[model samples]
Structure formats: C-alpha cells, structure tokens
Target: MDCVKLPDVGSRSLTTALIQFGFVQSYPDYSLFTYCKHNVRLHMLIYVDDLIIGGNDTAAIVKFKSISIGASIYLGPLKYFLGIEVAHGPEGIFLSQRKYALDIISKCGFLGAKPTSVPIEQNHHLALAKGTLMENPNRYRRLVGRLIYLTITRPELCYCIHILAQFMQSPRQEHWDAALRVVRYMKGYPGQGLLFCSDSDLRLYAYCDSDWASFPLTRRSLIGYFVLLGQTPVSWKTKKQHTMSRSSTKAEYRSMVTTSCELKWMKKLLLSFGVAHDEPARLYCDNQVALHIVVNLVFHERTKHIEVNCHFVRDELQRGNIVTCHVRTTEQLADILTKALGKEKFAYFLGKLGIRNLHTPI
Candidate 1:
C-alpha cells in the first residue's frame, strides 16, 4: 500500500485509476463513480481514503472488492461513515449524527440547558444585531462550522446556522448567545435525522420560496429551496440573494431559477445511477406572480430590469425541464428554511421533510 501526502496529487491519481477501471465519474458530484452494464449497476462514493461501495448486483460488488488496489479493507455495510451514523431497517436507511451533536452540546456546556422548542426567535433580526464583539471569535467560528456539518442530517438547523454563519469574522455577544441557543435546541432531539424510504417511486419534485428584503443590513432577500427524490430529500439550501429585489415576485422568480438549476443537476446525477427521470420535474411555489411569469410572456416586459440570465426558469419551463405549480403558504415546506417559525409551525414543517428520531417515541 502506497500513501500520497499531497492532496492534489493523490486526488488526481485516484481519479485517473478509477477512470482506467471503466468507472465513470459524476460531473455534478465529483466524489461519485458509477459502473453500469446490462442489468448490473455499481456505485462508489469516495472521500479521501474512505470508499463506500454499493449497488444491485452482489457479484459485481465482490468483483470490485477483489480488484488489486494496494490493500483495502471492506467495512461491510455502512452503519457509520465519518460522523454520520446509519441504521438500516424494513422502513429504509436512517442517517443521523447523534454522537457529533452530543459532542457539540458537551463542548459548549449545554448538556443540562433547557431545550428550546425552536432554534431561533420568530422575526429575528440577527443581521442587524449589535452587542459587544466576542473576545475569542475562534470559539464562535468553530461552533458555527461544526453546526454547518451537522446540517447534513439536520435540515431544521439550516436557517439558524445560515444566519449565525454570517458573523463569523466578528461575531458579537448576541450572535454567540443565539449560537448557544441552537445547541440547547439540539439537546431536545440529538438523535433526529433524515430517513430515506425503501419504497420510493424515484420521481423528482421541489418547493422553493423567498422572504423578500428579510435582511435589514443589506436589504437582500433570503432564498430557500428543497428538492426531493420521491420520499427522500436529496438537496436543499438557504442563501441570501446577492442582488437587491424591488418586489416579492422578483425574489420568488430568482429562487425558482436557483431551484431549476438544482433539478437539472439532480436529473443528470440520477441518470448516472441508472435511474432515468423521464417526466418534467414538479416545482411548487407559493407566489402566484412567479408562476404566472413562468407561463406568460407579458410579465417579461415588467421583469426586463431583472438580468436576462436570471430568467432561466422560463427557459426551463419552455424546454419542459420543470412544471411549476401553486402551493398554499401553509403547505410550503421551504418556508422553514427562509425564516424562523413558531414551535408548532416549525415542528409541522420538520415532520414533512422526512426527519425522524429513532430514539424518540413514534
């Protein structure tokens, strides 16, 4: 077994060998490699020296394991990878970072703190908070950074983490307190995680929303979108828009464009896995004006001020890549990602996102 210390050279060498072995790398996510032939299919997810091998054919997996690649140890079925703990059952695969979450609580001295129903207060103006600057910004940054990784299995933490992450350079006391509040919330359900069901139809659908001018400091809109593969959530994001929006319609339109790009990439990635998405992806938005803009040309005249490039949602509609639909505000799942919500609403949205905690009663 040979070890390459340089990350760049090691990654390049590994990629070259995998390509030579007839495995096609995924362009959307470079860490993924797939091998498909006839009725057999194989997938390998690589992260540095660790590799997860799986697929339909058991024989193909054994064949790949026999390949001469220095010395490798098969870890059997994935129960734990990196910090993520996986539990497989009749329902599906359950993924969580319980140990990691507990470690954060222990480190922050929040193990005994009372758990809050919500991570953040509703209508929080975190961006405009003013207080004493942290004497040790390193602690604040480290906590926020770890929370960011914990979001892999805890989607409910995305919005609060996104807000806290902005003050990394010079976090104030208020920001630090907010970060600790999140830790307290984690104490309530440290074992909560995402569940990928076994019996899914493999269809693609998405919900997108925007909170117009939500950030008081920059007056920029907050955009959030969630993508699902049948019953499982494959991708989601909450980001502050770069450009200022004059109207809520424009903000929602920009969010749809962002989600359309994610849908296209997800489609290609699924194809690599031998799953073909033949139908137009369903996109749900609560804004009527944005839905109208997707199907009407007259709205274009009013939105001409929005950069031409930002109108790609319309192009995707025309190309039949995605079908837009209207969803009531109460039913929008992405709403939690865009703003802070009350306990009942937050818990309601969390349940819809396929999040479950095995340690808690059903």
Candidate 2:
C-alpha cells in the first residue's frame, strides 16, 4: 500500500523528473525535450523509459544524470534507439533498423530467396479471390504487420504492405507469396535507411498522388502522399478510399485533401519544435486537374460528389499554407505508395525517397 499504482503515474513521474533536471518538453508533446539550465544546452528524446541524449555539450548530459530519483542509464554513443540504428558523423545522422529487418527476413523464412529492386512487381494486382486460402491466416497477417512497422524506414514497401494488410483476416496463398517477395526485397538492402543531412534545406515540401481504381473488386482508388522536410521524408501514407471515386481527377483531388491536412499539422509542428518555416510550403502532385481544382475553384459534375470536408484543401491553398504544383508521374514520390513499378522505375523512386544502405561505403 506504500506505493500507489495509478494511471499516468509513470508519465507524471517522468515529466516531473525532466523539469527538475531543467529539460523542457518540445516535440511529440512530451517525447522530445531541450535543456538549457546553467548555459548548458542539450536535447533528449524519451521513448517511455529509454532515452537518447544528444548535443555538442557533454557536460550538460552529465548534469542531467546528476538529478537522481532515477539511476543514470547510459546506453552509449546513441547507436540504436527504439529499433532504429543511428550512424552519426560530421555530415549528419543516418537512421536504420537493419537488425529488425533481418529478424523479419528470418521469421518469414525468406533468407535465401531471390532479391528484387522493387517491393512489389510491376502492375501486380492482388484481389481477394485470386489465390487459394492459407491454412493459417495469422502467418500472413504477422508478416504484413512487420512490413507495416518496417515502412517507418522503408517507405518503398508502403503500397506493397498496404495491399497485403487488406487480406489479413482471410489471407490467401497469393497474399503469402506477395508478402514473402517484399521480405526478399528487403534482403537486397537489409541495411537500407534514411539520412537526415546536417546541411540540407529545412523548407517543407510534399509530393502526393493517387492510383486510379487500383483495387480490382472494390473499384476504389488508392491515395498516397509523402511530406518532405528538406530531402528527408517526415510523413507518408498509402490508404484505399472508403468510397469509390467517379474519375481519376476525383481520386487525385481526394488525395490532395488528405495531404493538405497533413501539411497543416506539420507546419504547426515545425513551429512548436522551435523552427518556423514561413516560406510557402510546396505540395507537388502528378495530376494537373487535381491541382487546378484547388486553384480555380470551378465546380462541375466531376467535383459534385466530393464531400464538403475535402474543400479544406482549397481553403489552405488560398491561405498559402502550401502551394500546389504539378509534377510528372515519374518524379512523384507518392508513386511508391500508390502502385507497383518496374525494376528501373522502382529503383529510381527508392533512391529518390532517401533510402540508402548503411552497410555500403559512403
């Protein structure tokens, strides 16, 4: 009875401890913080109990450990945090989960399988009835679940994992094979990860696109979008529409709606994180009709079925939260999230997404 086990006690304790140590919560609400007590500045990232402390000042970190309701837990040099391997140098930090990727490859038994440049084969369509049912649907479900987590660093798997996740409740043999192919693709660059360069531009830019009627039986389109803070991707999603779109323009416009909302939130986040990006953020889409709809505001038969909520995109465009522009399909970053691609096209997009292998010599 001496110790009380109450809801949020852990969070409260951590918050109280951090403030006592002069660390101010910054990003993700309370997950990341900055400390500047006694002219020593440092940044600390807290993932529950695990912590990653970083800064040029080593003494500030030692002072953080001095306030002891808790013991100092030094995991050392910040190589791995929350399953992401970090390689820090003069250039910047490179983040990867090579160990996690290898574990997924082993669990799915794709160790010796042939590797491919792309996660999904070109024009590969996975329908519900296309393959026979697997005896254990959980097996397929688990593999897809790992792929979903893997997408944190491996965005190329977004479309592939999104497709595989759909059949989790009743996975088929085709789904199993498709999921395995993604694992084999992971084998090609098991150490692939993102690089956040020290000298890269911080201006926010985004690429969004939609694949028209990619789902066969449902006839619903896939929406894909990725927001880049400089050359690094910060936010991305690949999801199937809940309702069917009447035309390619409608699908693409819907994708814009989602991306605009994400951009709005990201803007607010940047300001909260102590970096204000006042320059007009650039949002690129492959569909000209979609960009035109936001700028021109011409209502017509094609735009009739679009819900009222979707018009927030137009509102944001007017306010200049972001500027919508058209890019070619080949250069669209969201393409990786919308559909499968050929080896050459896939490799092109993969590199463009800032995914590089840590094992390779820089």
Candidate 3:
C-alpha cells in the first residue's frame, strides 16, 4: 500500500525473476532486457507490466508467451503500443500520435482555433516575459506536461515546450498564451510524426548544432543533436548548456561531446539488437571552425579555456570512432532544435529529419 517503497521493491523483484530466466539488461536499467537462449533470441522492453517483445524468431517468442503471462494476444505486426500508432508497409514503419494530438487540442479547447504554420514565431523570444499570474497554475502545468510527452514523436515541440516548462512554478498569462500557441500549431497537422524508411542503409549518422548564448536571461547556449539509424531518427535532445562558452566554437564542440556520448550508447544498443555497424558514425556540423578545432592538433588560446570534457569529441575523432563532416548551414537539420525557424526553413528541416505527416485519408 506504500507508494514510495513499492516501485523499488517491484523493480528488484522483477529484475531478479527475469534474470533467472536468462534475460539480462543491456545496462543496469531494468526497463530494457534481452535474452539469448539456444538460438531463441528475445529482446523485451519492460515498463512495469507493459512488455514489448521483439526478435527474429517468432517460435521463441510464442514459446515464451505461453510459458509466462498465461494470457496472450498476437497482434501480428506492431500497429499500436503505448500511445503511438504504427503504419508499416513496404517502405518502412511510420509512428504517429495523431489521435493523441487531437485529444490534446480538443481537451485544451483549441479545436476551432486557426492553426499556425510554425510552432513558434521566427522572431519571437520568451525571456522573463512579464504578465499577470494565471488564476489556476495547475491547468497550465498539466497542459505543458502533456505537450512535453508529445515531444517523443513531435520534435518541433521541443524548443517551445522547453521554454514554457520553465514557468511551471508560477505560470503567467504570457506563458499560458505561448503554450496555447504550441497547441494551435499542433492543430495544423495532427498526424505529423517520424517515418522510418526501409530504403535507408544501415549506418549511423548524427547532426549536432548549437545556438550560442541565445538564452536572453542565462546567456547559455542551446545544444541540440539527433541520431539517425540509416535514415530513421531514433533519438534526439534539445537542451541548453549548463555553463557559458567563451566562443561559438566552444559551444559547438561542447554539443559534439554531448552527441558523441549518444552515438556511443546507440552503437552498443544496436549491437544487442543484432545490428552491427563496424564503421565509425558520421557526425555533421555546420560550424567549420568547430570541425577544424576537433581535427587539428593546435588548440587556440581562446578554445583552451573550454573544459576538458568537451575535448572527448576530439578524442573520438582521433580514434576513428567518429568522422566529422561539414554540412551547409541551410542543410543543417539540427538547426530547428537550436532556434526558431520560419515556415519555409522549418518545413525544410522537418523533411530532412524524415518526419512527415502520416495523415489518414479522410
């Protein structure tokens, strides 16, 4: 009956029982588990009782299902799980939360509102925007929370949500208004989501970008990176850096370090899933100076002030674990994450990231 002690107890008990059955975690994270037994390979992702199992051998999966869980339903191919709807075809699988998005819009009472072309305005900046406090902060908090979860399938919402989340403690009218704008933007195309194309070759490629000292209040740069498995985007993060960077190149190199960590973990994860990418992952950057600092030995006096941790990306390059390639600033898909873009630029980057509308024919 105690809530605090229950989760830890349940996790330990579940991990112990699963490990006994030959299922081992990729890391200490009990949520992810894999079991390879007698050519019957199985990968199970467990979040409490919700289990998503996948593998090459269906016989092994069916055998495990019969042995455990007692009751089972085979959906053949994964069409829906959690809140994401999957559309699988010859091209690949498309994941969408269109209905979930619509539900958010309807619940927020923005169903009749005019949809915006961009989530946030191109020149709009929300920094300590002063306005009267909302009568009910709880409603704003709850709405922002729902929008935050939507970033899983909707990357465009990342920056907007990140900005709005800062005001949860005391949401003002301006904050509420900004949050509503994001909801209205979502109304434009509720079916927009990521597309995993089968045509993409099995290679690891990542793009990293930063908006240096863009935050008006903190002056800390925003770091953003997205990793692509072949052409399918799997992981992404848009976060403001913790500390200030003396130079733009330092900010970018810092972003590269953050992205490299993700690439390393993804490689290990793919290996467990039977995807072995022996080649070094390609990392694209729009800043030529950052790439120069990474590949060249001479660290300028200006960049020497950068923390030692940021140089790990340089080490990764030297060791052949990654290759830094130059990409045009206009073609930098990660640009959307670092700053707000207009309709034309936003649409271009959205297409580049392989996120498209999985619109159902009306």
**Cα lDDT tens digits for candidate 2, 1-362:** 01111223377788787787677887545677777655556776666667666665666666555555455445557677667787887878888889999899888767776787777767676774567889988888777878889888878778888888888788878788888888888888899988998999889998889988988898999999999998999889999988899899989989999898898888876664557877778999988888888887777876777899988988998887888888987798898888888888878887897878868521
- Enumerate residue pairs that collide in model 3: none
All models, RMSD in angstroms: 3.0, 4.4, 4.1
Candidate with best lDDT: 1
**lDDT of model 1 at residue 302?**
79
lDDT string, candidate 3, 179-220, tens digits: 999989988888999888878888999999999998888899
Q: Pairing residues by index, what is the TM-score of model 2? A: 0.90
Clashing pairs in 1: none
lDDT string for model 1 (1-362, tens) is 01111223377788888788878899878999998878877788888877787888888887777775665666677778879998888998889999999999999988888899899999776788878999999999999999999999888899999999999999999999999999999998899998889887799999999999998888899999999988878899999999999999999999999999999999999888878888999999999988988888774467779888887988988999899999999999999999999999999998888888887611
- The segments of candidate 2 whose C-alpha lies over 4 angstroms from its true place after superposition are 1-9, 26-28, 36-41, 298-304, 360-362
- TM-scores vs. true structure, each candidate: 0.95, 0.90, 0.92
